[model samples]
Target: MSLAVVTLKKGEGRLLKSGGMWIFDNEIASVMGSFVNGDIVLVHDFDGYPLGRGFINTNSKIVVRLLSRDENTMIDEEFFEKRVWDAWEYRKKVTDTSSCRVIFGEADFIPGFVVDKFSDVLVVQSLALGIDRYKEMLVELLKKVLAEDGIQIRGVYERSDVKVRKQEGMEPYKGFIGEEFSTLVEIVENGVKYQVDVKDGQKTGFFLDQKYNRLAIQKLCKNARVLDCFTHTGSFALNAGYAGAKEVTGVDASQLAVDQATANAALNGLSDTVKFICEDVFDLLPALEEKGEKYDVVILDPPAFTKSRSSIKNAVKGYREINLRAMKLVKDGGFLATCSCSHFMDYELFTQTIGQAAKNVHKRLRQVEYRTQAPDHPILWSADESYYLKFYIFQVCSDR
Candidate 1:
């Protein structure tokens, strides 16, 4: 079948010309060829210049997700195999390939699909209509490529039960993609052990993006009283405990998370110094303040407060509130590590929010360091979505 051609309005190809991979529906001037949702179509500038080939979905605001810029490039099995291999080879150089984000959606040149390898297991999330069609092929290619490196992927699990799937005109799905093995997968990072519940845990059962950020907080935790907020499964708390912190408190609203976190602490034999509490952080923080609670190190690794651009204003308030409370809880000369995982919460805005919080609390902040997601999750330049997660380590002092 002849591929459909999608022509963009004049001046609308600037984003694509600037190396971005997304084409908004509004930018499209007209559709000359017949192609349904999830079909591979050729994109062209108003002057009929071939821009690229992408998956088209009229249902999505992101009308087209460019897969290749070359007009002659074939979007076939071999293409995916090379893309997967390239992604894997890149990970080998910059990150621990044993277990890390092997493919990060658009950043990996595979738009709307995410793949995380945990030990011998692979967890995938296919979000876009077009990418969903090639997910199985990508998985097979990934296994083949990894096998070349002598690493065996025993099973593949799909965690496609995300709300975003609905936006793509597909029902959410979850379960094993192929042979079902024990869903309980164990992965070790920075020498700490964790049992990831790939079947029913948050976002692929673990937040591997924060792998290095958690490690970055270890140096400030020795003999310090540490408080980790929104400590999903207690990754940061465990790191603090393993770093020889005097005491570590991990707070989460979900009891299941607290239970899992407690078990994780026991798994590493850090339960003696680490504890998990099930309570709303907002409510708990105020009570702790009333009790004059203070910690030598406070870590805020909250989920994305805002997913879309429209909610950035409200997200700023949420970020500022938590940061203000966290800063107040830090004793003089104490360290505070705070981060926002929302891409909508841009770097400059997040830093400004933190600065405002410090000022509101009348605290002086001595910048320690700044970091982002682990190198494994590469942030492709010009692709703003590739860059989320802003982490800052600061020493808080009393203005008085």
Candidate 2:
């Protein structure tokens, strides 16, 4: 069958040309040949120069999500197997494959598909129509590749119930991909145990992107009083306890999260040192200050304040407010670890926000180190979306 062709207008596709994977609808000049959404299409520049093949979806703003830059490459099962293998191999080299992000969507050259391996269980999120069609095949291929290394995958869970699926002309869905087993799976990271609920927890149960970032905070926590905000599952707070923190108080808005975090603390035998509170960090921060509370180390890992560019202005205000409060609660010459997971926040803006917060609180920030997501979640340079996490560890000193 003849392939559909999508030709870009002259001087368009600057992002694709610069190594990005998405081709927006606004960039295309015309489409020729018969094809339905999610079908593979050949893309060409204005001069008829072959750009490559990608999955097309007229229903979405991202008209084409490039699968390969090589026009000859087929988007077949064998091709997908190779892609999965490459992603797995890369993770094995950079991180522990037993619990790490296997396929990071566009960063792994497989757009809109993310597979995270948590021990013998795999959690898959298929967010695009083109990739969703091949989800089953991809899971099978992943299981097979892992089996080759004697890693037996007990079950696969699909967490594609995100609103992004709706934009791709697909319904949101969630459940076991194969035979249903215990949704609660245990995995150890940085010597701390966690029960990852693949079925109902937020965004694939646990935040695997901060694997090393959690470890980074542990070093500064030894024998210190620590405050962890937005303590999802108590990863950082538990790490602080494991690092010999004298006291650790974790705060989160969700009761479910607090309960899970408390269980995780007990599982690791750190309950005595680490305790979780179900309260809004915004309210708790000021309340703690009013109570004359202060800590040696304050860690903030709040959720993404803004998912879209339009809300960035409001998001910055939220970020600044929390950072300002956290800084105020830190003891003089204490450390503050803050991060923004929103891609729209960007590095420069996040840093500037923190600076503004320090200035407002009459504190001088002495930078210790700046970090991003763990290596498993590789940041593709050209794809701005791939680099979402920005973590900073600072020593806050009273300016007075």
Candidate 3:
């Protein structure tokens, strides 16, 4: 039996008992001995009262991602599969299609792992050292479980190419489990079809998290001129065009991405209604404003603003600058669809930044429909960071 101890300070163990997972560096009183990354540990109160069992990694900021409260049982594939099945049942009740995040890290009681399903294929990304240790087991179980549900395991590609993985002393690795699938895969979301790039595209090859939020913008883009900044593959712009927008212009820094967006528009048979421009979104937005261009709806979904606390100040600056410019580009009574995926920057902080941007630009926000990750990406109360995606759709009331 694996035995170790993680001592929590006097009252800090309260959350632990209350089902709050994640033992931060400060929460631990001591290891009481040496422990390797992914070693199973028994958590205890300051007085050594038995708390629960979880995996530990001294190298990561989050020291532990607890698995169970039972000590008699062992943590293995069954333990993980049980939790995953429960999550799967919940998803089946909520979603009809196979497209969604099947397992959400802490929410599924298996921290450090996330699995997103797109039709028959599965995309997995591991962020924690402990989770990395069980990567094989989890993937095996996930593929098996998915197969039973009529989901063919097209590929098991790793998008661990993220920045956080480097901090854990891991390198970037990505490819198909056997052989790569066609980078171009057709995906249907809310009755709208999109061409996705899985091998070399963004996270999971598509931002499925914004599935519903983009649909919301579609509801408002009727007969409107729309601008989609940072339009990676033109999710927002495509939705606007499908929703009967008078016209939609997509902008991004990647020429290849712009080409994909153009192809996607044609795929949707809306090429005449949409166009793509390859350029920096910041510079392009300013030029559009200078050209006396005013849009009825503007979408600003930039990449993570802050990767760490140290970069938060600059992130705030970047978010505010772009949001302020987006506000100006919107005509009176227009809509602004904006978002931030930086977990370090809280929703309140981003809200304040956007509110300040509105004030500086003399635009009044008429309404705010704050949204988070899609139903597929469950937010385990134990881990707030897992709930990173946020959307703020508001009416840009102007003096015009």
* Higher-ranked by lDDT: 1 or 3: 1
lDDT score, candidate 2: 0.95
TM-score of each: 0.99, 0.99, 0.93
lDDT of model 3 at position 379: 74
- Candidate 1 lDDT over 73-145, as tens digits, reads 8999999999999999999999977679999988999999899999999999999999999988999999999
Candidate 1 segments exceeding 4 Å error: none
Model 2 residue pairs with clashes: none
Over 154-226, each residue of candidate 2 has an lDDT whose tens digit, in order, gives: 9999998899988999899998898989999999999999999999999999999999999998889999999
The lDDT leader among the candidates is 2
Candidate 3 lDDT at 15 equals: 62
Candidate number that wins on TM-score, 1 or 3: 1
**Runs in model 2 with CA error above 4 Å?**
none
| Candidate 3 ranges beyond 4 A from true positions | 13-18, 32-35, 178-183
TM-score of candidate 1 against the unseen true structure: 0.99
Candidate 2 steric clashes: 0
lDDT scores in order:
0.93, 0.95, 0.83
